[model samples]
Target chain A: MGATFMLGELVGGLRRNLSMAVSVVLVTMISMYLLGLGLLAQRQVDTMKDYWYDRVQVSIFLCVEGSQYAACAGKATTTVQREQLRAQLEQMKPPIKDIFYESQADAFKRFREQFKNSPLADQATERAFADSYRVSLTEAGKYEVVVSTFQGAPGVGRVQDQKQLLDRFFAFMSVVSWGAIALSALMVLCAILLMATTIRQTAFSRRRETGIMRLVGASNGTIQLPFVMETLVSSLLGASLAMGLLWATVRYGVGGYLSKALVDTAFIGVGDVLAVAPWVVGGVTGVAVVTSWFTLRRYLRV
Target chain B: MILFDSVTKTYPKATRPALAEVSLEVERGEFVFIVGTSGSGKSTMLRLAIREERATSGSVLVAGRELRALPDRKVPLLRREIGTVFQDFRLLPGKTVFQNVAFALQVIGKSRSIIRQTVPETLRVVGLDGKEKRYPHELSGGEQQRVAIARAIVNKPAILLADEPTGNLDPATSREIVRLLDRINRSGTTVVMATHDHEIVNEFRKRVIELDEGKLVRDQVGGDYGTTTSAIPVIRLDEAGEPGQAGDPGETGEVR
Candidate 1:
């Protein structure tokens, strides 16, 4: 019964300080939403790294006409040169895992697909690109060995390892993730200030009520509980709404938009949504509760 | 119900103690008036009795417990047994009279069913039977004091401490409020009123504890409202002394 009375007080208090309460809710929601986005972005980078890092290959481009390398000999590479290169890769201690030969037609087709919307797409043709041998090593570290052995031996125009490119890509994305986190940290500080001000106002406006409660022999905890619960309930409302909206955004916005837009990329799924919900709701609610309780402890004496 | 054994309370920066070696004992179910001018330690005495401020360099015993040794957390429990009504009739503005009266029970963790049953009855006893829904501003000074009184007694505390309860009321309203307190005292609840009103003290014959500069100058049963440094031609001072000194005299205005 006493619990019910205190609940009534919480509800009444929320209604009485509706504007301040709404400010707390909105601030908490926005900040926590950003926090959730940061976490999700970090998770996305990790998954993308795991997926892409293993499949990355080093492409050994064969010499074409007018290639610069002395091994090219100012003419296209012959089939015998290609055969010798294949034989050398197969003889390694841990054999190279897979190899795919991309004809000039294949390279030009891939280039067009990759730069589908670029202005250069209409300007490229088959002869402008070189035919390449895509070689996957058992370990990506073996690229150094391949580059050393085959650099100027024969018909090798360039030895480019995809791992170098992939590392730079992931590094840029990690920076983006950290930037999101830093932005969210700033927003969280804003959220804390908003909640503290709201609680101070509530305590000040209800100064008479709390004073009377104190005179009537109420415990300090009893007097403080309603105000704490008021902030708690409202922030929880906002955080859960943020979580719900975050889930929808992840499910429909990121998944739907990025999946069809980039087919080779592995997008986060509904399971990731569930994995990240608790941190958003729990973290935001915890901050709001603590801020409110601390404000009341300082500003409102029962 | 209350005993102050040489209690002295000095504020943090003050030169002299607000109360200095003041000793007084009020038994259960007695009406004792603590009469003094402003800053004469009347309110300080009440605050100490309620354990609002700790007594410095002395012991205060209330409801059979030493207040100076009492833990801060249990001070609320001690306060729960003592009802305090102040001069301003400190009713919460947004709450109704019933809520104000029921607030005491709620503080003590009483159930809603019990508060509903007790508040209306207590308000009716204070002659506010049908005005339970009115806010404090809607009530007169006498009515507000009645509500404050109702709030004070709703818990059926062993003692009711009133600090200038009638200070804001007119003379006639003061008498009515005093009569209500008399009725409460007649029902065996100890009422300690701290006031400067000489009329109520002269009109109603009870034990009056008059303090001058934090010192107990007079403790008299059937005592008059002594003027500053002079005794008045009112009720004679009965040498009731303490409870043990008076030999457990049952009530006031009896042997006199």
Candidate 2:
């Protein structure tokens, strides 16, 4: 019976202050959207790292004629020198997981295919490229060992680990992910303050009823439930709206454009969005309900 | 039934106590008036009875429960047994008279059938039978008080505490309100009214408990509203200060 009364009052409170209720809902929606966005961005960063990091290789470029590199000042890579380099890599302690030798012709063919649309492709020739051995390691961090053992070796121009090329980009992405998470946290704080203010206004507006409720022996819980429920309802509505927006973004924004646009690498699918939707619903609703409970405690003295 | 045993309520940083060493009791089904000036602690007496404040010293017992000993959670349960009507008529402006009266029952978790039957009957008793559909603003001052009375009595409380129920009404309406209270009293509920209305006090001739500067100067059966002629010699300090807004009575250690 008390539950019914409170339910009635909750509906009544929402009706009495429609504008404030809408404000709570809107603020909650925006905050929850930001929260979901933060999670999605972190997931995207992890996706990119996994996709790119797993394929990183240590490329050992062999010395070639006319090479200005100091390591190549001795002699151009002979067939015996190339064969000896391969033998040394095969005997590495960790053992190269995979290794492939690319001749200058193979390198030029790949470069032409990569830069097919660029005019730089027409200016490149087979001799313009360098013969190199691409080494795939069991652990990418072992590139330093490969670099020390092979640097300045006979017919070796330079050992370039793919990890270095990707590190700065990954680090920048991490900073962006953290920034997003921090911003989401700040937005949630603002939403809480807005919820608290909205509830306080509703409580203050109906204080006469509350004072009488207190006077006539209505329990504190009875008085507070209505106000708390008002906030919860608004927050729930906001969270639900946020999830819908996220679903739409996943369907059209990510699945429609991002995944297709970044065809060369990997992109998060709708499955990732589906996986995160629950937290958006559960997390924001939890925040709303808990904050509402606390906010009501301060205002519902009656 | 109510009992105040050696209860002295003093506010912090005040020159004098609100109620000084006062002890009084009322039997079941008694109508009593606690009359005093603005700072006479009439409001404080009602606040104490409702357990809004713990007594600074001594105890206030209402309906067989000592307020000081009552746990915080149980205070609401105690209030359920008591009805209170205030000077402002504290009606929910947004609600109709019916909703206002039904609210008391709803808060206590009363059944829908019981609320439906009791609310209308209570409203009828206060001469507000046809005004149930009207909002508080749609009703007159007297009608609003009647709605407040209906809300108070719908729960069928043992004691009805009226703290200046007529303070906002004109004389004619005040008399009408007093008559409604009288009618309620005839129904066997103990009505404790605190008022400064001289005419109603003289006319009703109920038991009057007068407080002059927090001291119970008089407690007599069928007593009239007394003037300064009945006032006892007590220190007058902060005559303009509000006793109702005083500090909590629980802090006995604060008194020096």
Candidate 3:
């Protein structure tokens, strides 16, 4: 009897306050959608980092004939200097996992292959290319060790970590992701405040009913249960809508557009959204229940 | 059935006490009237009886239990055995007459079968048998008060505390309400009514407890409107709207 009566009250309350309930749904949906997007963005950054870091290498470019670098001193690298650099790198085997030497001939061949369709390929010669040692690190992030050791050494014009440039891009992505999460936090706060206000207004309008219920010996739990359930149902609706929005974004927006446009980089998929679904729904429901309970306690007084 | 032992009630931030060490008791099945002017602590006494407010220096006992010692959770159980009515006829405006009465039972977790049986029966006793579908706004003032009475007594409470149940009705309607309350009281439920209606007091001739300036000035069995003066004189509309003579006990010691 209690369950059925409570269900009836829940439905009736929602119906009577349809516009308010819809507003709750919409606000909660927007907030939770942004929150989900933030979570997915964080995951996407992690995936991209894993994909790119495994392949990153530090390139030590050797001085070529007539090079302008101060280390080159406008002289070509000698066999002794080249041999000394290779021996030092070989001694640092713990940090340097593998080394491959690309001669000027090889460098020019690869450069032409890369820009074969461009007119610039016709102007480049083997003399224009620099002989380089590509050093793969045991740990991709330890590029600093190699750069600090070999920079401006004899026969070396420059030491560049491929991961450094990638790090700046990744840092920017991290900022964007955290900014989205922060904005989502603000939206969730707004959702809570709006729900509280809706509950307050409902309580005020039904003050007479609550007072009568109190007089008739209704327990606080009985009076407050309907209110909490009302908020829970509306918020759950919003949460489901948010989950749908998130799923669609992952399925079409990321998979269909971003994956096709940036084929080399991996993006978050529907499975990642499914992983974050429980936390988002659970969090929103918990907040809605607690907010309504506190609002009813302060306002309804039954 | 009800006991107030030296109940002294002083509201917060007030210059004077609302009820100053007043003591009173009404036995089982007694019909008692608590008569006083505005702010004479009549409502305060009722509120104390219902555990809405605690006595500052004394205790109140209802249905053989000390209300001061009652926990907040158990207060609802205590209130279940005692029904209350007010001057404003506090009915749920959105509910129909039947739903308003049934709401009292629903909140207490009564079964649907029990509610279906009890609501109509109680409504019949309140003389609202056919008007079950009418809302509070659609009903007359007297009818609305009847709905409130029906809601109060629907659970078959042991005591009924009415704080001026007939205050908003006409003289004829007020007498009818008082008669209905008298009928309910005769059915073995203790009735404690606080009112300023001299005509009902003089006609019904019940036990009267009059409070003057928060002091229990008179407690008389079969008391009249009293020979004492009041801040707001009771207008006797039943006597062709002419103000009745104050300070006259007319007749006493008879429960007619």
Name the top TM-score candidate.
2
Candidate 1, superposed: residue stretches over 4 Å from native: A69-78, A91-95, A123-128, A137-154, B229-256
- Report the candidate with higher lDDT, 1 versus 2: 2
Write candidate 2's Cα lDDT for B1-256 as tens digits: 9999999998889899988999999999999998877788899999999998888999899999999899988999999889999988988877899999998888878999999999999988999888778999998999999999988899999999999998887778999999999999999999999986666787899999999789898999999777642242121112312233124243112221
From the highest TM-score down, the ranking of the candidates is: 2, 1, 3
For model 1, residues B2-50, the per-residue Cα lDDT tens digits are: 9999989999999888899988899999999888666779999998888
TM-score, chain B only, every model?
Answer: 0.88, 0.88, 0.91
Estimate candidate 3's alpha-carbon lDDT, on a 0 to 1 scale: 0.88
- Specify the poorest-scoring 10-residue window by lDDT in model 3 chain B: B247-256
DockQ of each: 0.40, 0.54, 0.59
Give residue A141's lDDT in candidate 3 (0 to 100): 70
DockQ of 3: 0.59
Task: List, residue by residue over B191-235, the lDDT tens digit for candidate 3.
Answer: 999987777898899999989778899999999877443333443
> In candidate 2 chain A, where is summed lDDT lowest over 10 consecutive residues?
A1-10
TM-score of each: 0.89, 0.89, 0.88
* Candidate closer to the true structure by DockQ (higher is better), 1 or 2: 2
Candidate 1, after superposition: displacement of residue A275 in Å? 1.6
